[model samples]
Target: MDGWKVGVLHSQTGCLALAERGPLNGTLMAIEEINAAGGVAGRLIEPVVLDTESDENKSAELVHKLIKEESINVVFGGYTSASRKAMLPVIEKSDSLLFYPIFYEGFELSDNVFYTGACPNQYSVPLSEYLFENYGNRFYLIGSNYVFPRESNRILRDLAVQNGGTIIAEKYVPLEATKDVFKPIIQDIAKLKPDVVISTIVGDGIMDLYSAFQDAGISSDEIPIASMVTSEVEIEKMGHAAAAGHIVAASYFDTIDSPENAKFVSNYKSKFGQNMRTNMCVESAYCQVHLFAHALNITQSIDTKALRAAVLGAQFNAPQGRIRMDVENHHTHLWSRIGQIEKNGNIQIVAETKGAIEPDPYMIHHAAERWQPSLISGVAK
Candidate 1:
């Protein structure tokens, strides 16, 4: 039995670098941990890393190279829906598995992939209830022009209107948009004065949008930019002082007070850097590797067929809490938490689900009542 080879596809240098780098770090760390502990049945897991450079087309080309040329059957990476979609046909045709670790708008599912991130029901639904309840119903929507932000906004609009909330405006910008692009949005935000600025902007644009708001002297206390994509990674990069008071909804945060998370954080910092932080992407990336290792051990084979079966109904005590891969859906059941960035760049959990919420990828089972009782208050904000 030879050592197993897996592909690590994450954008190293690009607009998405700030966002994708943490997951790459986490994936490598987890592989190291498994290999150190006597990797899958004594065969080390070899990761063939690639730099997608945050380009969707490039992501597709590199993934083809990984599978056909490199012969990697298992791959772990992907930050954006666009990249994932671009790689989908190749993955499905080759019958390989891609472990995706970023939360995204849930509308599609694939057989050749294990989704380890939160779906909208697990993130957006609970988050919406909180925002409308606490921050008020009128929301100003701004997002990076892409499928995810657009889909997420659709979900938010449905939820908002159902709850008698209103969307004051909806806007989209290019991924390469500058801070100046947000100036007009700020003007409208001030004029309309929505109760909350709901932002789904991704990549470098996140920092730019926040910075523009800060420059405009817009107080978050007056209208915080409650975000779906911003995490400690962005908060850390954007500076704690600048990122403070903004909200983020995800399955995990760096500051979750739990034994599992504490250990994960400690080991991660020790390996990466004393100051390196973990967010939803990093935590999920780390957990999926462990989950894959467990599956590999149980089946004693890396065959996509055996693994596809073994990975289902798998459970791991993740940094966020108990998480499970749904046997039927292939989407992870994950904890939901809404956090506000602190002055020190930590996302302080303000509200959380009682337990890991079920994934509703297609939103077929979605209902307003499902989110109401799931979340409970945490540290006072």
Candidate 2:
């Protein structure tokens, strides 16, 4: 077998760089580890890196170049749904595979893309149920003005109303907007006094939004912010004081307690440094590389048909828990977890599903009640 040329297409310098960098680092780390272990199938994996720079157009352009010019068959990166959509056409035309490692709004299926992250039903639905049950029945939605945030909020609204909750208000801000765009939202929160703020805000905009909330003297204790994208890294960027008491739903956290997770965390910190933060995206990227290697081993090639057939229903003991790629939808079956941001900017797990939930990207199943439990103290703030 010839050395496989892989494409690394995560943005390294755009508005979403703060979040995308984690996945890029995770992907690189896996490559290094795999190469050190005598390579995959005795063929070294070579990476051709491209900076999408958080631009959807640029993401699409670069993906086409990777497939055509660089001859890379497998691409691993795309932190946001907008970027993924932008690249979809090029991927489909070329029949190349993309290993997307971030949780998204779902409702998408592509033969050219292998989704390694949770779908809407995996995080958003469960998170909505958690907030509605514990925080109250009123919610205000805010997010970056993009495909992911918009579609995610739409899904959340449906889940909330189905569970007998109300949407007090909804708003969006440009991905690269400044504090000015968030001020009025904070003001609205002050006036409406909604039970909770469901934020789909991503990237650096999160720091601005959280800071504005604190500046307005609106504490999470007043109306806790519930989120699917806000991670420990964002909390650290927003500062402990501003981000504390907020709730986040994810498939994994740096604070998870497990022998496998501990070793994963230890190894990541040892290589990246103890201060670096590891979140869901990072872990999924790491796992995707291993999953790809296993598939390549099974098929002895990176052909789309062979790889997909080999990887369908593939199981991996991820840092979060045991996860599997659903053969039907090509989405992942993941464990759902709810965590409250602590005063120190770390997440404390408060509620979690008992096992890995099946991927329901199309939302055909109604299992929101599965993750909802009796309100626990210190969770709803």
Candidate 3:
């Protein structure tokens, strides 16, 4: 087996770095562990990392450089949908592969990329259904001005409308906006008095938004803010009070009770530091690497065409559950779980699906169907 060089592109310094850093750390940890375990195909994996500075244009430029100049074959990284879309053309043009590790708005499929994150069906649908069931029908929507939030809100709005619910208000803010900017939005939310607030805000903007909510004397108990993007890491950074009681729908949490998760959390903390936290993106990043290793073992080459065949339908006992790549859509099946942030900066998994939920990136067809997946048998192991 010949040595395989891969590219790792992520935002190390910018608005999105708060979230992107976790995936970067997770990917590096996986590479280190794989190298320790006799390497992939007996050939040490070489990673060429490039910081995109959280800029979409920069991401595309760097990806082109990685392929044409760096001569890397397979690559992994990209936290935001904009960043991923920026690199998609480059990846496709270069005939390379990208293993994207963050959950995003679907309605997209590329032969040049493999998505290891949750799709619309895996996160948004379940979350909306849960809110509709547990909360009331009236909802307020807010998010960063971006493709992911806008698209996600579109899916959620369709689901809410189909289920006889109403979207009281919809709003958006710039990606780099601060908390002071959200004060008016918080006031509007208070006046609307919606039963739930669906927030799609990402990156550092989250800190300000959550803080603004708190300052407005709004608590999750009053009008709980539910999100598909918020994670344990965000909660930790926002402080316990700012995020407590907020509901988040995701496929993985740090508090998942399982031997595999325990080992994963332990190893991550040991490698990154005790102060560092793990979230859905981090777990997906780590799991995707192992899955890629399995694919590499089968294909024994770095060619994107061969690797795609090898990756299709590959399964790994991930920290979340048993996740398998979808042969038809190039996505991964994942377990859906709704978590509430506790005061200790940990998410308490209040509800979860029984088994792996199939990927459905294109939500255009799923709007009329029920969003709930099969219920969990009992406590998640």
**Residues 70-169 of candidate 1: C-alpha lDDT, one tens digit per residue:** 9888999998898999999999999999999989888888999999998888888888888977889999999989889999999999999999999989
Q: Tell me the TM-score of each prediction against the true structure.
A: 0.97, 0.94, 0.96
- TM-score winner between 1 and 2, please give it: 1
Tens digits of per-residue lDDT for model 3 on 41-145? 799778898899979999999989988998887889988788888999999888899999999888899998899999988888878878877899999999999
Candidate 2 structure quality by residue, lDDT tens digits, 182-281: 9888998899999999998887888898899989998888899899988977887778999889899899999989998898888888998888888999
Off by over 4 Å in 1: 379-381
Clashing pairs in 2: none
Answer with 1 or 3, whichever has the higher TM-score. Answer: 1
Best by TM-score: 1
What order do you get sorting by lDDT, best first?
1, 3, 2
Model 3 residue pairs with clashes:
none
How much does candidate 1 score in TM-score?
0.97
The regions of model 3 sitting more than 4 angstroms off are 364-381
Worst 10 residues of 3 by lDDT: 372-381
Candidate 3 matches the true fold with a TM-score of: 0.96
